[model samples]
Target chain A: MESSQNQFSEWLNKQIHSSNSGAFALSPELRATSLSVLDAGVFPNRKNEEWRYTPLREILSQSPVLADKTQINPALIAAFKEAVPNALHLVFVDGEFSNEFSGSISALDKTGLTIEHISTLHGESRKRAEDTIRQSSLSDDNIFQHISLGLSRSGLFIEIQKNHEVDRIVHILHLSTKSESRNFSNPVHVVRVSENSHMQLLEQYASIDAGKALSVPAVYIEVADGAGLDHFKIGLESNQSDHVSNTVVQVASSGVYKSHQYLLGSRLTRANLEVIFSGAGAQASLRGIYLGNADQHLDIRTFMDHAFPHCSSDQHFRGIMNDQSRGVFNGMVLVRRDAQKTDALQSNKNLLLSREARVDTKPQLEIYADDVKCAHGATVGELDKDALFYLQSRGIEKAEAKLMLTRAFAAEITQEIEIETLRSYVQDRISNLLDGVHASNV
Target chain B: MLSIKNLQVSVEDKPILRGLNLEVNPGEIHAIMGPNGSGKSTLAHVLAGREGYRIDGGSAYYKGINLLELAPEIRAREGMFLAFQYPIEIPGVNNTSFLKKALNEIRKHRGEEELDAIDFLDLIKKQMKLVEMKEDLLKRPVNQGFSGGEKKRNEILQMAVLNPLLAILDETDSGLDIDALRIVAGGVNKLRTKDNAFVVITHYQRLLDYIVPDFVHVLSNGQIIKSGNKDLALELEERGYDWLLDKAETRD
Candidate 1:
């Protein structure tokens, strides 16, 4: 299985670098790079620094599910419809787009953002798409990008025109149900927030048993002077899949970027979040809450760079690990030489309920300039025994007290989410997860 | 309804309470007055069943039940209360809710009906006035951010609400001003009853001047060297525990 996955990764890298038809064409160089990374990914010891805590060796041991060429997953689709019925939904089944399960295609143009699929990018409109891909770095160093550019044609893309804000949310649903599939998928969202424009994006990932799902989903946000964007990623993937999700966010002069992630499921799910403060006075907030249980291995690596002066960034993430599950939170904050007075703070706190449950948190700060207010800290432990006794002494049953305190710990991060409905929904999900584990100290 | 027979306690292989015997019938107020390090507070803690205090060679009886065998909460539910000299400061649990839990625990154990929220609030309001504690403090976390006098008053409120048969006030008068001390003493004084007893563990005779113990026992070096009436405390106050200690040492 290891050697097979290696070959597939190598093939993927070759395909990515293969310079092809047009500007939208998959270059050989991109494919070769992805292939090499996946090839090297064969050894559990060689998984990238981001995958250090959550082992991918077990994930690679499973045979890859052949790609599905059929219908979208009804169960996966039903999950979202039950929760977010009003939002527009685009279906991607086994790394292939499905127009049959989609809703309201006209809403994209009407909402002032251009939406397109990767599979059908071979016509006159392909000229515009090709120009953008080559100019942008979405395909850089990513294997999913190579295959997504090569064989896939139905990926989703959204572009917000200059100086306009969308009032509705864009939901991209990835539903897969079959196995042994060549799994190279990319869900790209190009959001151009013109000067003073605003936009909010909701990205959801879900699937059924199939080849390990590699999502090179890239969200390119160009916030012009004075504009703002709020991006939320909700990962409710199937229980039997491996996923790698990348989000590249760029902020311009005086812009604001608020990003949030919720890692709910998947055998092995790793998220690479890169946010750059490209302009002076720009601000960003990256908040995440990962709840893991059983054999789940989830890692979220956040790289935030303060490239200009007077930019501010805050990253506060916490995790709850139960049973034999493992969780990792790696946060890096960098202040460039010229980024003076760049106020930045990062904190990662975790709660391990079971003896086997574990969390490895590393918070790093690299400040090139002095006179900056930058502080980073990480804590991994169970609930306070004294605090627990205090609650138990109050007649609160042991079980109920654990749940309340556990919820209270995560409340600090989830409360700051900009979307009211999203916040409440995530809170409910967290409560249910705690209730299931029976370790959530209320 | 509390009795102690030959209660001796030690820490780090050294005795603190050596062969001390005392008993307080219901409706009576007894004071244990001594200088610093008299093991006055240790006696209160041992009675309350705090962790890590070696009983050495004695047994305490509360309501005819072996008090030492029960855990702190179980003892608490069985009508045994201790007003700690230093009440614990819990940062998140609210004071009102904490007292309510204690009340219900004892009530439930005694086969009595539990107080509902409204009844509980009413009960708390009545007891708060005894210690002059404002409603705001009850709303805050247990003993957290409370002044020293306020913490002492909170302990009394717990005593009043729990209504334990044996209420041991350990150094209750240590950090209070005149006004605060009176409020605290008044609170304890109101709870005096034929079915409940008060053990006022104090350092000076001044608090006894207000609470007015029926019996004063001087504890020095793990032993009760002197036991007398209210006049004994006045004499010790005028002289000091050191003078009494010196007299006892020379005789030994």
Candidate 2:
């Protein structure tokens, strides 16, 4: 494990040295911080509680080659961007931001929203992005976050001004063009919604054809007092692709932060999301569905910190595994000593469609404060037998009945998506995924 | 239209239906009454092709085709319907869409063109009135959170929509009040015709008063021990099933 870890670190060093003139070079201070963390030579393994249930061997065994410029299918991009019909599009192909496909941020100059590429930002803008990155509450041992900070060559810095209600959503599409080698991308996105503001973001990661690549994108979000931010992340990479992402979010007084994730693709995916309430009367609602097929392995970890009083957090995640796929959901809700009147709820349910398919869900609640309400529950089972027989008795074929019940299980989560087009797009993708799953009554 | 000859079934190596037999022609309603634990539900379930039942012997033929060989859905598509005694509450499945899908599948099996959304809605609305079912219940999940009466009414509504050749009501009046029973039986009466038949299974004779049966049979120990006309139900209602059981035992 250590030797494999060294291989990854060595590869990271090579990436930093080879991309001499790449876009979005890390600042000297950021580079030094990342180097110090990497110098510790402490990479997560199965021994690490946070990394348990997820094997890093697949990602660490192979080296990533620098992606070469290639022609991407215009129709593919056109079809993928249809998920969000009316939104500010930000296209990132092979790790670099595509100016041709992206919308003009200049049009939003008077709308009190500042959207800038990390490489183009200078002086105060750069400093603000860096400041937010420094203030991220992610633990120092998260080497992946630091790796993205130090070696990222493509990212964006978005800020919504105080009291501004941004009507348009920021739709970021990470399109991995087909590559001959196993390429890698780690784009760091930093977003700050100022006081009393509201914003929505749709971040999607997908690949062209069955591209073999690794994406370790890191995101930092800050929702100020009275602000609201709806962040949705969808991992729809190809079956040959692998993804690992880190999201750190902080919400201030009376702020609202809602996160919805759909992990429907990729051979292996590990998503770590941490939300910390920094002030009183704040709320956080987290919802996600991880649907896997074949040999896919999807893992989701969430950490909700109720450090302030009068704050509430609720998380509901569902998993559906088919073939030999496996799913893992590990969530922890913490109420600190002074965090009184805190309400937190966490639930995780899983459905195994095949005998080989499996799921491991652990929901943890640690309450140090009195006068708090916290509840958690977890369930893992196959589709309801009675329900299946019921549909079959109604003349729906067994395969179609299984699909309906599976789709309905997912719709329960996708219905929370406020955007009609996006919700439909996600639901359609789920249906397509379920369609390909062999109806084996194992 | 339906024939059962010495049908034998077992559950987990324990015999539930020793040798149940019955026969009914088109346009006739046969009411099967029995005391509890008389294999009433088992016969209904076995006929509907539910799993976990071992068919030890005997044969059930519908239109001269062996009913035991087909899957539950195939049996359903072949114009066989079973209104469950305990309707399964399926969350996330819309009642209207479920019925529509059932109807379309059966139509497809019959080489008939499927109904579009508009036509289906029209047909469903017209049939919904037969059972006095609320329009909102059509939009909700199938039988989820429905009152006992509503579930029974939904079953009748489904029967009305499907128009099966042989409809078996397995204790449809079990949990219904008198008014609900009337509405449900009324729905069945409206859908009756010369081309289809009904098998009304119940524990009490009250339901027979509304949906009068041409034949009444007493099922005991998984076999029809006694068969009589509709008046037999009233006699059983007055004397209870013990008298029939005693007479059958004396004959054995």
Candidate 3:
């Protein structure tokens, strides 16, 4: 494991010194920001609540090598072709952007939106994201501000201009292929939504037979005042993968930020969805659904920070754990001092379909504003026996009845997605998770 | 026909129905009149194969088959019905849908084809009319938000739809007005046939007045002490259970 870590670090250090790493145009500060994060260190085994559930120790012990930055694997390209046919299809293999496979993104080639890799962007194209990440920080210790600040990967950066309405979804597909041996992979992203801009970003993650793929991906969202952004992600990594994806969304004055995540793969997966409502009347809705089946273990933790007055956010997350799989949902809603009229609600409900399956749920609400309304609720229970019997009495077999109730419970989260195409896609994927039944069957 | 030969029912190791015996032949409405604590409801439950009640002695044979060997649902499917004194309130389940499921299960058990959605709706509408219940009531959850009289009428509606071979009415008249009783009794009377029987377990003879019974047996101390024809019910009603108490003591 030490040798693997040393090998991975050595490879990353070489990439930093490589001149082609700066082959594309970049601001001096931007180039430094990319190299500084990698130079900092590999994430420790356990420190933040975000890294709690995933099996990172085993990933670190496997001696993962740095992902090859110069090439794209045919297997990963093939998988993305089948999984996301309608997507604009931006492919990133082993933490490196691939121009050969994703040069002209179909979704980003249209008007009203500007999409480019962080390495290719120059001047205002790159400065805007860094400035938003800097100006949106309410504190010096903000996790996303530092993580995104440290993010060095040359990944997708989407900019939806002020007041521009983008009807098409911008899909970011990150695929990893660690050829011949165990490897460590890290990917980072930054997205900026201009004032009053409306757009949806769909992120998909997958890996194929890439031994010990360690994906520590970070996506940062900057929503300007009065702008609305929808961020949706689907994490379906190969079975031998360890994924740690963190999303940091900051909302400006009266801005609306909505996010939905679905976790169906990764041997051990943990996702942190944090929304900082920094401006007055800014609304943030954090809703997502997760499915854990077989021996897979999935953990989803969410944090909503209400740092401004008159800001409202509501979060509802549900998890379905079957077989011997385990799931965890920890949601915290924090209302800071002076953030009055901050109405935020957080709830997490999980269903453990089998006795062997387990779910640990926690909902915490911390309110410093006396006049604010904040509430949190968490419920962990099994399927209602009477409800099941009632359905069975209607001639629906046990499996079918359980599926119906599970779908109904999960449907609440999917319905909250304003993007119909993404919503339907998630619904179909969830149905397929049960028994490959398409969402249209419902 | 339904026959209870020296049946003993116990709950929590205390015997409630001690060697009680009664018989109901086809084309008969045998009203089992009893005072409180006389195990009147026990007989109804025992006949329906409700759980937690143990049969310590004897046996209950319904249509030549041991009724105790069957589950509650199987017994229900085999044309044996027990109208609960306090019907369970199943929320989130539509009343019409519940009745349709029960009706279809019973029909399938009898080797009859199940009814479709349209036919089931028509079936429920016709049965609902038998008890003079409003059509809207059928749309609500089973027994949820139903008044006492309405709940009882709905039970009778279920009986009419299921068309059981033996119908045991446990305090069916306990919570009903005269009009409601007349409608429920009229529905019961309309379904009476030589191939079917009714075991009306009541606290008072008032219910027997609407659907006049062929025989009346007084249930006291878990056993029948006196038996007579329809005249006995009116006589008992006129003189009250006090008269039967004296007659029971004299017979002892």
Q: lDDT per prediction?
A: 0.73, 0.89, 0.74
For residues A1-442, could you state the per-residue lDDT of candidate 1 as single tens digits? 5474455455544543546434332334433444555444444344556556756554444444336476554665666644455666777776566777777564238557666664344444445444445444531244444444443334555566667877766677776565554355555544556678788777777666543565556555567788888878878766666777666677888999988888987777788787887789999988898888787887888888887999999988988899888898988898889999899999998988889988888898998988689999999998765555444433345565577667767876787775677778888888888898894432
Docking outcome class, model 1: incorrect
Pitting candidate 1 against candidate 2, the one with the higher lDDT is: 2
Model 3: colliding residue pairs: A4-A63, A65-A183
Error of 2 at A279 (Å): 1.9
Residues forming the 10-long window of minimal summed lDDT in candidate 2 chain A: A17-26
Interface root-mean-square deviation of model 3 in angstroms is: 5.9
Two-way DockQ contest, 1 vs 2, winner: 2
Clashes of 1: 38
RMSD of 1: 5.6
Candidate order, DockQ descending:
2, 1, 3
TM-score of chain A of each: 0.84, 0.96, 0.84
Top candidate by lDDT: 2
Candidate 1, what DockQ?
Answer: 0.18
lDDT of 3 by residue, B1-252 (tens): 788899988999988998888888888999889789999988887776656788899988988999889766777777888787877666545677667777887778779999999998888788888899988988887777999998899889888888888888899999888999999999999999889999888888888889898999998888887889989988887888887788778887
Task: Please give the DockQ score of every candidate, comma-separated.
Answer: 0.18, 0.70, 0.12
Instruction: Look at candidate 2 and tell me the lDDT of residue B137.
Output: 96
